[model samples]
Target: MNELLVRSGGLYTTVQDTGRFGYYHMGMPPSGAMDVYSAVVANMLVGNPDDAGVLEGTYVGPRLEFTDDRMVAVTGADVPVTVNGESVEPWTAMRVGAGDVLEFAMIRSGCRVYVAVSGGIDVPVYLGSRSTYTLTGIGGHQGRKLVDDETLPLGAAGGRARGGAAVPEALRPALDVPAELRTVVGLCSYRLTEGALASFLGTDWKVTKDADRVGYRLRGGSLDFTEREQPFGAGSDPANVVDLGYPVGSIQVPGGDEPIVLLNDAVTGGGYATIGTVISVDRDRIAQTKTGDAVRFTSVDLDTALAARRDRRERIERVRREIAR
Candidate 1:
């Protein structure tokens, strides 16, 4: 087996892939990379499978030394990176000599950075994924974040095909957040007061610092449905009771009259009233939002949402072709 040693593991470095699925019923949160699109892009750049295990780095990246020559790609947040002391850019495939050292600094734009190897990190998978879920100790590198002195498995390296990998110049994801995040009205929408639905759809909210793997808490105008109006009003939606199944993008209103948008590591079930769910297409924006960023939820008809998703997929495909060329 080839070796990839962590000489100096940085802050919050962990092994992640797409995520563990089909186990939420067993009370396992699908812990994975926060910016899944970026992660997949980096993996693809290195010619790895879309779900290959990669490194999810936050704020800083580890000091790593390779045991053999290999091709690698790093993407996601703009974390200053260097080989030995020289600089490197994100979204570019690079060759690392056996003794070369790679380092990453503080975050400049977003919070997470993804590093993907040509053949992907050679780690045993659990529940069909190699993502690290620190909360429950389930998948990924020992089911916890990587730390100093940790050794990771490097994929087979003898005479493997090597090539440069890079993101297409014209098809890079926009760093700017979109104006409105599309949502599908939920079953519990009726529980909220008449204005609650409209207020959530039209007004703006800011992302609070109180966000983490579980969920993002939003701060905005109070959405009062009153204690009396809620119990039976919005029935069977995400928020109506505790322990009901929840999907990733579920927006549930708790007692504070504010909604919390569930993310990648959100719980499988909860006791709250869900007003709406942000569609899968707009989840990337929610993943990159920083504290104090303004976000507005907009309701869109099913057709518009489907069309938007199609456009995004087409754009990504075009970019892939360009990069391949």
Candidate 2:
């Protein structure tokens, strides 16, 4: 039961696990790590379970001091991580002794970074998750991002870990600009004119400053709805429909101009018409994209979405096998 002392809590650092699931119907969004792949891979590197809680950092990373010897790994963003100011490689497991300082440099690319220790963050689990939903202050350290001088508890490590455990080059995600996101087009897409739906797939949308764990609002795309009188109870706005459940990763155009892709901590349901959903696997890709990054959506069928899921699972299995080597 060692502790992790926070030296400088970098920009928006919070504890996250796989996610809080099955609570969306009550308007509680799953608050979890945005880049699921990176988070899981990081835990794997440290020989922890896939759902172990890790630190999620945006733009900057927190500086931490370990209270005891532990294994650690950094993943997601290609940022420089240092041990007591000495450079270390990322995407690989390393050992930290008691009183060792871990710090991160500015993000070189990508947005979120995951710091996984051998023992997961030991915050009391609520609703079966240790993830922090900061909007409502539900889980994690006070349901908020870490602050300077904060101390985080660590769970007991389930197994041993060796330093230098690495995820091979090919297995890493491409955080390339103009990330192409696979979307399953259906939902309430019927409300949009054929030309408008085409415009959505055809345009390269830019992530706006409004992007966050809740949702990503994109600019550079406008959708025109087919002419129709407002339905009973639906709002007068053309973008509005009967308030319905918004699937995680669902896309909605509020003003018919800015299209928002809901993410991990997004609201559960709203009156806005949802065009489609970014396939679950592609959500990992979108998570890495920062404000100002270019994004394009490509329509995919249910089968394609399923195939992508299988591919991701297989890749993860491969990483597990590699770590065992």
Candidate 3:
């Protein structure tokens, strides 16, 4: 069997696929690639299935030595990639011989970087996914971030990918600018005063150090909740509501100061009142943002959100066509 030797597992690196579904009701988040678009694109560039398991690296990245020939692609963050100490272009397929070492430099912009090989990472799948949910120690390689000197198994190569096949600059996500997340403002929005809602939208929020796969805590402006008698079964906190399901991407302000946007690894339910939900597609935008980055939310209707999803699907299709050539 083919294997990848980890020379240095920089920061946090995990194996992830599309995501595990049909289990969210049991208190498990999908725990998939945070930047789904980049992960999918990297898989495509390497001729792997869209859901093939890939490596997701946090602020820093990993170094690996290949045990066999393979085609590899890197995407997501704007980070420098090198093979055996020589630079290679990202968002493009590159060939590596047996013994070739892959490395990454400090991130230039985005938070996470994705590396997809021609053959998917062959970690044992659990609950219908290869994704790592580190909180519970299930799935992925031992259900945690990679450590140096660990060996990972790789599946057989698909043989369709060619070195130098590239994703066009126009199709790649722009990481240099502040993210403007399109949100469907509703749910418990009635709990906030009009001015508070306005402030929530108007403020340019900065991502806090608390940002992670579970949620992004942002700080900027304070919001005021409408006064109401605490309901039975609800906590005394003004932001508290009866415990309810939290849809991924839902925004909840626990203290009227920091708004947390829940992501793929967030809790399934909580008592906090969710003021809105960032649209599914825009979650990709937020995933690339790092600590200290600025982001703003734009209110939109459900129709607009669906349209944005369609646009992203079309873009992925375009990428498929482009890489096939």
Candidate 4:
């Protein structure tokens, strides 16, 4: 195994894979890389498994010195990275020799930066993922964030490094908001009051400061729901609410009427009524939003949603075609 000695771990760092799945029934949310698309791309660049153990850094990235030569890629946030004081671009794979010092500054645009090493992080997996769920204290480097002096072991490079993996120039995914967010009106869409659908689809919302892996509390004009007799016995797990099975990406609006977009690490069950769910294609955009960023949710019918999915799939196919050429 190779070694990456942590010299200076920045703000918050954690080992993340594609995330835990099929365990939400046991009250475990899929807590993995926030930018799963970018993370997968980075891993693909280095020929690692799409769900390999990568580093997810918030606010700042970490500093590491390698024990052997290896290829690594960084994606997601645009955190200024440098190797021995020389600047390096993210989302591209590059070689690093032993004793090379890699450092990263705070995020400039997005929120999380993913660093994928050549042979994947050599951490024990739990519940089918290497992600850290800071709340439940499971998986990922002892179920916690990275700290200084943590030397993580890496698997052997396996002697394959002929092709350089660069972030596709045209496929640099945009994460900015105010762009229309596609949504499949939720299981609870019919509960909204008259005109509520129009208001929700046309309104602008800002992300509040209280944002994290758990959920995003959006600020916008109140979305009224036709009041009805409340149900009983809903137990909110992980976050503690009346029990109602909560799906990831479900936008839950409590009595306050503001929608809260649930993310990967969100609770399994909750009491708040979920009005809409941000479509999978739009989720990456939502992940990059920050406080006060303007966002608008667009209503896409089943047909439109299917078409959007097809368009994205075609884009991925195009990227593959270009890669093969």
The number of clashing residue pairs in each candidate reads: 3, 0, 0, 5
Winning model by lDDT: 3
Models sorted by lDDT, best on top: 3, 2, 4, 1
How well is each residue in 1-325 modelled by candidate 2, as lDDT tens digits?
Answer: 4799999999899999999998878899998999999999999999899998999999989999998879999999889999999999899999889989999988888999999999888899999999999999999888999999989999886576778989999999998989999999969999999999999999999999999999999999789999999999899999999999999999999889999999999989989999999999999999999999999999999999999999999999999889888
State the lDDT of candidate 1 residue by residue for 1-325, as single tens digits.
Answer: 3778888768778888888888888878788777777887777677677788899876667888877777777787767888888998678878887888888877677667788876678788888899888887767788777889878997764333236656765555555643367888875676677787788777788878877667888888777563453344445543365346677888988864567989877887766766788887777667766667678898877788789789777876765665577
lDDT for 4 in candidate 3 is 87
lDDT of 4: 0.77
- Poorest 10 consecutive residues by lDDT, candidate 1: 229-238
Point out where model 1 deviates above 4 Å: 158-163, 177-179, 226-243
Q: Between the candidate structures 1 and 4, which one is better when assessed by TM-score? A: 4
Which residue ranges in model 3 land beyond 4 Å of their true spot? none
The better-scoring model by lDDT among 1 and 2 is: 2
Off by over 4 Å in 2: none
TM-score of candidate 2 on Cα atoms, chains taken together: 0.98
Worst 10 residues of 3 by lDDT: 173-182
